[model samples]
Target: MNIHEHIEKWQVEDGVHLFDKIKLPDNSVLIDFGCGYGEYTISLALSKKHSTVFSVDKDERMLKIVQDKIESHSITNVRLIKADGTLSIAFPDCYSDMILMYDFIHGNTQEKLPIRFKFFEEARRVLKPNGILSIAPFECEYLRDSSGKRRRYSLGMLISEIESYGFRYSESIDGAVHFDYYHSPYHWKKLNGEMSFDYLEIGPVMNFYKQK
Candidate 1:
């Protein structure tokens, strides 16, 4: 589907309602980390007229797509940044009111624990004194073993990891989230070589607040 088509689908699928649940602040700077193709970026940008969004991604191609969509839709509140994958952020300390980590944390390598630690540290440093961090984990597929069996984690496990960095669990919406293409929608073929489009799965969205 084209970008417009995807945006249309999102609107029809409770995108506005889901964003409303996040309670993004107006007249504030927000960051969408690891944003692919600007689905949530665009949604957040248009959600509040006074809010400015920094859409960061490591992929230049995806950044370009975001730029194209922003230009096509005449959206001026979003700034696209090509991420360097480093723990350091160029912004000043306590700069952003909100930081979004959606469907991308599972991509971390299990061996590189320090890098992950530094990432949360940097996130805490850049977040405003009372800013919030929102996360939407992809699925259990990201937690599978070598044999493809799912490794389950309690909500406390996820909460403890983030809280260890000095954040507090605020609230969460545990239900099916309608995903845009970059987060979901995989195509797989059946044993008979027939193609199927019903391959993507949805996950829950969790929110956390930074402690002073």
Candidate 2:
């Protein structure tokens, strides 16, 4: 299958529609953390025609995938950064309008939570006022292995940790929830107490946590 089809399969397998949750402002500068290949990144770049996008991933193999894409499509608006997920990203203060962590935290083990939180803290620092942020948590951020299929997290830890970084709050997408994530409205509600949001709840939707 092609990338779109693959992402769809991933959506079904993981029960999340990452692409749909995000709401981009015109000319926004967006970043896709942990962007694997260039599927969603390219889609975001193409969709947000006037915006600049940064596709960040530590895996060098995927760089070629993304490079092939940006080159083939002749798209100049994306910047690819190679760095460790938990390390502080090198960007100026308040530099981004949107940041996406697609299955980023989940990949790190418990030992890395500090680093993960640091990334979030740094992300919050660099985010512009009212900037958007999205994360796709595939179960516990600490439990790396095959357990995600069995051990589901409360999302409370994830939410609290993220909120502690100083993001204000926003609503969630709640209609037809993504079929892949296995998380319900209750999960989102639990994650963001008293925070409200708009939900596409459908395939390819984005789940946004705006900068306070």
Candidate 3:
């Protein structure tokens, strides 16, 4: 299936099931950072109708797509924000219950670590005490360190990095599907008619809680 078909299926069927594993509390304030194409954002909005979801992205086109989806589904609880790439969130302190960072953190290069840390600080600032920070670090297997050396990325490394930013490793949900377009390698094979598969790319969703 094409991207649109996959998105439609995800919003109506698969995405909701995927999000259920995270066990987000109803009526909470949530943020989907770097909400590309808004697949997860739409799914989140649909699944937790009472929750207020903020879909933040630097790209206007992606936000437009999310807006269209919200209008089509008559979802009123989702707000879209165009990020300015300053590693800053527009909300006040202790305003959100959760922040979703699915498929956003990648590369892991030395130069980018400071930016990531800054964003983590922003996340900590916006989340209420003990709030959730869910992350799915897809495509982060290989990374370069500060000395231009290659390093392998692992769950432990991720946990350590997050812990340094005042978040405690809470839990992780395995077998979570990555819904982004380029992240699913099998989709390309299907597009080229090389092979057929019924499954999407699977990864783990790591959840962390803010420390008071």
Candidate 4:
């Protein structure tokens, strides 16, 4: 299956639903970092619900894919950029309504350690006071497989790191991470009460909000 279908196989369509939950005002601008194939960005901008939605990624191939999608669908509000996903997100200060790192938080690679913090820092820079930064990594990463062969950050640990960036806690919904939040039936079913997080993890994958 293609990446989209592959992703869909593991989520519940609530990636967008979670954004809807963010509750932006009329005509808000959104920055979708690591936006792949422009699935969420295109569908969202096509709704004409935001003032502008910036779709950015470092991959030229993906940018072209998204470009074709926008052109074919005749979507006009999205501004696609072929920029690095972590650094060079160049929007003005306090200019965005929200920033989304949908499933990219796999952990900082060595090359990104220097610029890694910039992702959230830049989001903080461009976000309006009381704006939102929503990060949804794969939930499975939080726990080991039944046999305990893998290692992922615990929900509590992820929260502490984000808090270090100065974003206060809000609330975390009991839901799947990016993997299942988009389209997995069995995954979501397995998730029923098995994993839960606060909106803002004062302590993990909780929904979070900015402090005013």
lDDT (0 to 1) per candidate: 0.70, 0.61, 0.79, 0.61
Cα TM-score per model: 0.79, 0.66, 0.84, 0.67
Candidate 2 lDDT tens digits, 1-212: 64345444443333323333455678888888877765557767766668898988888988778888888767788889896744776678888998877656655354423346567777887788778777655435345223323234456655665677776545554322332232245745765643222222332223445455
Residue-level lDDT tens digits of model 4 in 10-115: 2225444544555668788888788866666764565445468888888898889888877876778888877754365688988877787766655433332334
Question: What is the lDDT, from 0 to 100, of the residue 181 in candidate 4?
Answer: 39
User: lDDT tens digits, residues 1-212, model 1?
Assistant: 75446555664354546666777667899998888877777777767558889999989999998898788768889998888877666678999998888876565435334344566788899999879888886642434333433467566776787889889988887643435443333422232343222333556778888899
Winner on TM-score (2 vs 3): 3
Please identify which of the two predictions, 1 or 4, would achieve the higher TM-score against the true structure: 1
Model 2 scores a TM of 0.66
- Which residue ranges in model 4 land beyond 4 Å of their true spot? 1-18, 84-86, 107-115, 139-152, 173-206
- The C-alpha RMSD of each candidate to the native structure, in angstroms, is 4.6, 10.3, 3.2, 8.4
Residue 144, candidate 1: Cα error in Å is 11
Residue 20 displacement (Å), model 3? 2.7
User: In TM-score terms, which candidate is top?
Assistant: 3
Clash counts per candidate, in order, are 0, 21, 0, 22
Off by over 4 Å in 1: 1-7, 11-13, 109-114, 140-152, 174-199
